[model samples]
Target: MNIVVCMKQVPDTTEVKIDPVTGTLIREGIPSIINPDDKSGLEAALVLKERVGAKVTVLSMGPPQADLALREALAMGADEAVLLSDRAFGGADTWATSTTIAAALRKLGFDLIICGRQAIDGDTAQVGPQIAEHLSLPQVSYVSELELAGDSVVVKRTFEDGYQRIKVKLPCLLTTLKDMNSPRYMSVAGIFDAYKKDVQVWGLADIVVDEANIGLKGSPTRVKKSFTKGAKSAGKVYEVDPKEGARIIVEALKEKFVI
Candidate 1:
């Protein structure tokens, strides 16, 4: 099996900022890391490779700097890595991102596509389903377990309340949850290999991407504004006897108009 895993680089949540004028994420100088959830997806891909000795390809789309995430994937044992980088891909919403990624996957001709359940920065949970729709393939999101059957894949999906089992044909897409597996740390040898290796970079023109539906030009949703929430205050502590504490807290609550 040929497995393709999609990953994203996200701003460190604590340092994320927004451009006052554009109302978009101000990514300049912000520390970046692979989306936490995508690490699980990467681990799932490696597990599949171990199970069936499949070839794994890691794919990511972002600015040139996103090569960092791809290199990390390679260090985690992916066979090949591709970076889709172009100014035309800038400011792409999940819909446009899914479209572009789907087109690239079509060119790749893979048996399976794996992704994280959601990107940490966006947390919209739209890209996986959107990619499935664009590629016209079945998709299972929030998958905790995956097994390859004859010409099909079995998935165990997790939900807030419970889990569900589902079967999908080959050439399907899967969005993995964090509980799927623990991501393996990069080996010393793998780290050296990643540094020496070269990743294939594809631009918007190389992918024959439609200019009208990509980048800032194609995005429909607009962020009117974005601002960080102010830090919360630590409440005052009162020390008292257990019985007296309850009575005192009740009086304080009423005094504070919180009753």
Candidate 2:
């Protein structure tokens, strides 16, 4: 089986900062790492690879710095890696992003495609399902467990209160959560080999992408404005007897219909 895993290079959340002037995330100087849930997705693919002799390919789209994430994937045992980078691919919304990725997948081919449930920075959780739509393939989201069943695959998906088991045929997409599996560590040899391995870089010219279906022009969504929420105001402090304070609280609650 051949598996395709979509990974992303995201700013480390803990160190992420907001630019006061632009009201946007300040990615400059922030360390970038593989999205956590995407790591989970990668782990799932790697597990299948070890068990069933599957070949895993890691795909990511970002600036040139994203090559680091691809290298990490290679160290984690992915058979191949591809980085889609170009100025034309910048400022892409989920729709355009997924479209570009789907185009790449069309070129590479796949028996199964796995992606993280959501990206931390975007938190849209739309790309995986959108890619499925673009590829015209069946999709299962929030998958926490998976197992091979002959020609088909079985998955356990998370829901509101619990999870349900689902069986789907090959050539399907699954968006995995962090509960899927633990990511493996990179070994010394793996790290060295990662540098030796070739990572294919593609741009608009490399893929058969329609000019109207990539980057900002193809994206209908626009960011009108972005800003951080103001800090909460301090509550009123009453200097009165305990009983009087209780009475005031009750009266305020009643006025607000909290009673």
Q: Per-prediction TM-score, please?
A: 0.85, 0.91
Candidate whose lDDT is highest: 2
Tens-place lDDT digits, model 1, residues 79-105 = 899999888888888888988888889
Clashing residue pairs for model 2: none
For model 2 the local lDDT of residue 27 reads 76
| Top TM-score model | 2
- Report every candidate's CA lDDT: 0.88, 0.93
Task: Tell me the tens digit of each residue's lDDT in model 2 across 18-53.
Answer: 776766778788899899989999999999998989
Off by over 4 Å in 2: 19-24, 237-259
C-alpha-based local distance difference test score of model 2: 0.93
Model 1 misplaced regions, further than 4 Å:
14-30, 231-259
TM-score between candidate 2 and the true structure:
0.91
RMSD of 2: 2.7
Error of 2 at 169 (Å): 0.3
